[model samples]
Target chain A: MEKDHKPSSTEKPVLQKVAKLFLYTFLIVIAVVQVLPLVWLFLFSLKNNQEVFNLPPLALPQDPQWGNYARVWTEGNIGQYFFNSVYITASAVILTVIFASFVTFAITRMKWKLSSLVLGMFMVGLMIPVHSTLIPLFNFFLNVNLMDHPLAIILTYTAFNMPITIMILLGFYYTLPRDIEEAAIMDGCSVHRLFFQITLPMTAPVVATTAIINMIYNWNEYVFVNTFISSDKFKTLTVGIQNFIGQYQTDWGAIGATLMISILPILIAFFILSNRIVEGITAGSIKG
Target chain B: MNKVMSDKKVIALYVLPAFLLLMLLVYIPIVLTGYYGLMKWDGIGSMEFIGLENYRNLIVDSAFWRSARHSLLLAIFSVISLIGYLLVSLVLSGRIKGADLFRKVYLIPMLLSSVAIAQLWMRIYHPTNGVMNRLLTSIGIEQPPLWLADTNIVLYSIFIPIIWQYAGFYILIYYAALRNVPNELVESARIDGASPWQIGYKIKLPLIAGVIKVTIVLAVVGSLKYFDLIWVMTQGGPNGASEVIASYMYKQAFTTYNFGYGSAVGFFLLILCLIITYIIRKLTATKEEVQY
Candidate 1:
């Protein structure tokens, strides 16, 4: 191989250096491509329609209209939507993480007869497309008088996210040492106490990962909220931003601001907890 | 411990809430989707038994078939794009600088809502003022194409953003899998006078074949059922050039109130996803995987 490539060693180093530079340049270009649009979005969010249309995509506004954010917040239902998104996302995440933890604990720690069957059902739930369940769910919610209600959206998010949530938790739970459970049960700790006190606390790190995953899904979920919750008051930011954009279709700045507002929470969460997000996403998908 | 673990009442108490929600919401609705495909209902009206009429119409429904074909195209595109993602991952997983930062930077788009992504891409593809045409015109090209409005190119336009959104995810997965490839194997191959290309091709690729198979299933199924970006951006428009199955079903049931036919489309999507998933898994399942 060396004879076949009988080039000067110094020349080989130079060649490799050029290749390395090209590779880095390629990677950096993709990174910029990924980030540039959002940066453009932010730039345009501070510019009026004239500025947006006249100026370059990457240009800064002459006077940054911080007012776009305030205007959208004050005029549109954005504030209400933001509130709704927060509480609903928080509620769904809490419920999903808790419910998923309970089920995962039961499946992993318990010696139930039909554990595998029940677990299989939940696992199968992972593959069932949300679109297939849409019409029936809408009809079911309407029949039960839960349609157009926040609870419908909340409960649906919980149900749909349950499979993946449990899937993430299951890996964590399986690795949990049974000795702690044995010690607790040997001390006569009730099963509920065991789960809530020892097991749940022990699984807190994964619970947080699953919770973040669920939060992202619930926060960014569109179809369920769009279909089930028709009323403005019940809509979360993801759906509400649609209405916001529709109404302000001509106002480039307002639309940009609305989008920025809608995605800000997730971006903030990512900055704070990217490692967990990365872990959860990788664990959730590859395992599936 | 066994007594506590096997307590049926406790088990039921622990699992029933999540399990029942799955049954009532996810499981039951799927079954009902198939059942509703057999009935004639307008979402508000009483169901009248039609007995596979909807499915039959779906068979001849050229529009629906067109949408299905588009979905298959997206699936193929997604699977093909995996090779690109794998290549990038292979490069990133090597002794590259700032690989961690690059992976995360590439992931920024995946974190945003599809609504935001779609809307942003919509602006980016705007006919006159958008970045795409602007760049083309700046480079001395005349009459840059209208991207999202062109029936011939709308699907590809939408696919670019889809690729952008998911590129990080696939790369991250592949990078992880590649990093897990035993270094000793590569070292031994290197000592045996294999070139770098040969080492990557012959050694690293085979080691991560399992992950690649899983991703193929993911990308295909994911593309087949993709909705948010398409719905938000094109809504299967420009004379239905980019219509995928989910968006078609959505429009039928929600916009047209054709619950029966929509359910048929939805059921078809469900069956297609499941069948493809099962087939891919079976086809990709290795002999060693079975032994385990």
Candidate 2:
């Protein structure tokens, strides 16, 4: 094979070099495509409507209308919405991670006859379309007098996120060495203590991963909040921004600022926890 | 250890909270959705038993059928787009520098809420001022297309942002799967005189077939239930041109207060998703997945 290809060996390196360059260019172009819209969004957020219309789309803001952010932050209920998003997301994440951890511990560590069936139920929960449950859930909330309540939003978020949260935890739990857990049990560590102290600490990395994943989901969730919560006081940013943007439909800078505010927390979180985010998402999806 | 581990009371205590939540919120709601489809009731009013009238009407509901078709088109588009993602992942996984940074950049959109993405894309598709038309007009086109309007093109237009939002996600998944292809196999294939394309197509592609199948299911089922972006952007508007199944169901139930009929559509979507998922799983089921 070497003898047959000897004549073209020099040409091969040049061909490979050109191919590699093309591949790099393709990758870079996609990266630009992904990031450019966001940069454009940021630029328009600072420009007045006049500048937004007259200037080139990518041009920087002339005066940098910082007041756009201020107005949206204050004039509207964006601050309220932001706070609502924060606490609701935090509550849901805590509930989901703890509940998922408890269930995962029981299914994986504690011996039980119906363990696989229960685990199967959680796994199947992943595929159930949230839309299918919306109407009934609406009626359920209303009938029980929980409609338009933040608890409805929080509990729904917890329920829907349980499957993926447990999934991310399950892999880590399974791989946890049994020696420590066994010793703890032998020394008469109560089941609750064994789980809370011995197992939970060991799974903290995955717990953090699952926690972030839940936070992102609960933070970005829209359908439940839109359907369940009616009043402005209980609304999250995703739903709050809908009505907020409606009133300011023509105000490009304000609209941009509102969108920026809505997404900034997740963006900041992503920048800080991207590795775990990536790991969690990969673990969550691939196993399915 | 066995005595402690098999503690029935402890097991029930640990599992029941989540288990019951799943039952009430998920499983029970689903059963109720199907049951609700059988009754005639406004969301807040007393129900009158109508049997399967809603389902029968849905069989011939042109608008619902149109939305279902649109969803099918989106599903098809999503599955095809996976090929492009796979190709990009193949290139990225080919020992490229900055692959990590490139993938993370792509994933930024995926992290964002669909509502925000929809609002931003709506501005991007603004008839006169959007960057899309600006680029088109700058290139000397006389009249740029109204992207989210014009029923003929609205569905496809909405698909572009959907692609943008999810491209990174699929790429990341594919990149991970492609990277998991054992290096020794690639090296052996290279030493045996295989070209890069051949190695990628023959070795890497076949090895990652399981991941590819899973993604096909995800893209299709996900497309079928797509709501947020379309809901926020077009609201299945311009005379329902861009309406998908979930959006249509939402409009019926929420917008028109046709709870019974909406529940029927919702039930149909649930069944459709499950059936399609099962069929895809069976179709893609291999004798055995290739183990590294």
Candidate 3:
């Protein structure tokens, strides 16, 4: 009798089960919508124009054209653009992280009269649209003879990204205990040594977060490079791929291959450090 | 402690490099943009003093106003879509399996560059051979509208990919906010015979109002200045159907060599962003917020 009286009865469980199935279906459909285009892109990257139009969108090509990737890489100045993107991305990330680190440290750790004002400037810098500065920057770069130069792109990236990088680092810096600094000062450590040997290492995790975020931004950056760098040798993948696709308008496979190559690094990074990427993006944007 | 931490030289050494760069690149250029608007200069030529002529012209410029209207429409669409994102986050924040994996998958597009997304979507909308047309035709539709070519539908078409790119971001924010709602509040509410719908609407939504407000501001401002993807996909083509303020500014300064006019647009954009940001912040502030 007691067993029959249980609240976990047959009817309620069945109803809830159906609801759960419906909910899961809804979630899965959205996931598919988000991913389907990229899957289609990958599918066609291996097919010639004939297979692309003749076969179903999802069907695999009978003979995969692996040479599409090789041809574009060798013939389209992509190799040069790839390295340019790499070193420039690396340079900007390193410089922005370190420079932003220095500023964040001084603002949070060191005592200064104008610290808050200086920090306010960087924070306000966040809201200034990049386009507003483009004309003047173009003129400035041209005047300085830095137009079409990689350093122009690299330095501009560093300055623009500093605010958000510092913003992310600022939170982590504030949360750190003062005991380390007190101990370091007692041991006769100078400011530079204390920062390099202690504070910087301690903030490694957040640094890594900022570094990845900066890398993504720099690697994918188009406008500054598009506006400032005119020569192909200095162009990054984002801009280079634009020009490449223009020339290969009819070659769907090559265009697909080029797009794939442009995005592969970011995809790989996300695979490894997805949690950090998610955390960094959230910390950076939500705070604003 | 003050003596050790307040060294002027150390502070200057640390702060000046980044600060100067910000001034030179970010701050100074903004001021110069406004000043540059007062002159008539081709990008390569000397300036002629034009005073308020460009600004006056902009007041009546139908092309500029049309672009502004398109941007405003995008902003409205973005704000509306936030509701759908909120609903998804609410569902995911429930007792579900594989939520983490699903959110990560949704973020894949966000990770790729706008250029890549643009190039990929161009093919996906490739009128005849595109996946969209193929699917429609397979399902026995005799005709499907040309997406990017039709000016009437083109803006809305572009909005789809923009929504796709940003859904995960807003969902992730809402999901995080929802997760922070205390479980005890939810459990007690449930024990009191409140339905899931009631709890979600009354309890969960109110608790996350602050985050919702932030996302509203972000979405609206982001749409107002959107450029990269639009530039690549349509180049504001099919008769400037999808042009936004940033792209218009680009076309003027870079393409048409109308530096003075472009600078006017750029200055207007800067002021517009700041003013809108301030207005939104003021409007969204609740009475409870004022107490602090």
Point to the candidate with the largest lDDT. 2
Model 1: per-residue lDDT, tens digit, B183-225? Answer: 9998788778787789889999877888888899999999989
Q: In order, what is each prediction's RMSD in angstroms?
A: 2.2, 1.7, 2.3
DockQ of each: 0.74, 0.80, 0.73
The TM-score of predicted model 3 comes to 0.97
The candidate scoring highest on DockQ is 2
lDDT, candidate 1, A78-134, per-residue tens: 999999999999999999998998899988988877899999999888888899999
Q: lDDT tens digits, residues A1-288, model 3?
A: 112233867786677779889999999999999999989999899999999989999998899999999999999888899999999999999999999999999999888889999999999888989999999999999999999999999999999999999999998998999898889998888989999999999999999999999999999998999999999999999999999999999999999899989999999999999999988988888777
TM-score per candidate, chains pooled? 0.97, 0.98, 0.97
TM-score, chain B, predicted structure 1: 0.97
lDDT of each: 0.90, 0.93, 0.91
**What fnat does each of the candidate structures reach?**
0.82, 0.78, 0.80
Which residue pairs in candidate 3 collide?
none
| Order by DockQ, highest first | 2, 1, 3
lDDT by residue (tens digit), candidate 2, A1-288 = 222345646787677779889999999999999988899999999999999999999988889999999999999889999999999999999999999999999999988889999999999998999899999999999999999999998999999999999999999998889999999889999999998998999999999999999998888999999999989999999999999999999999999999999999999999999999898989999878
Decreasing lDDT order of the candidates = 2, 3, 1
Flag regions of model 2 displaced more than 4 Å: A1-8, B290-292
Query: How does residue B182 of candidate 3 score in lDDT?
Result: 90
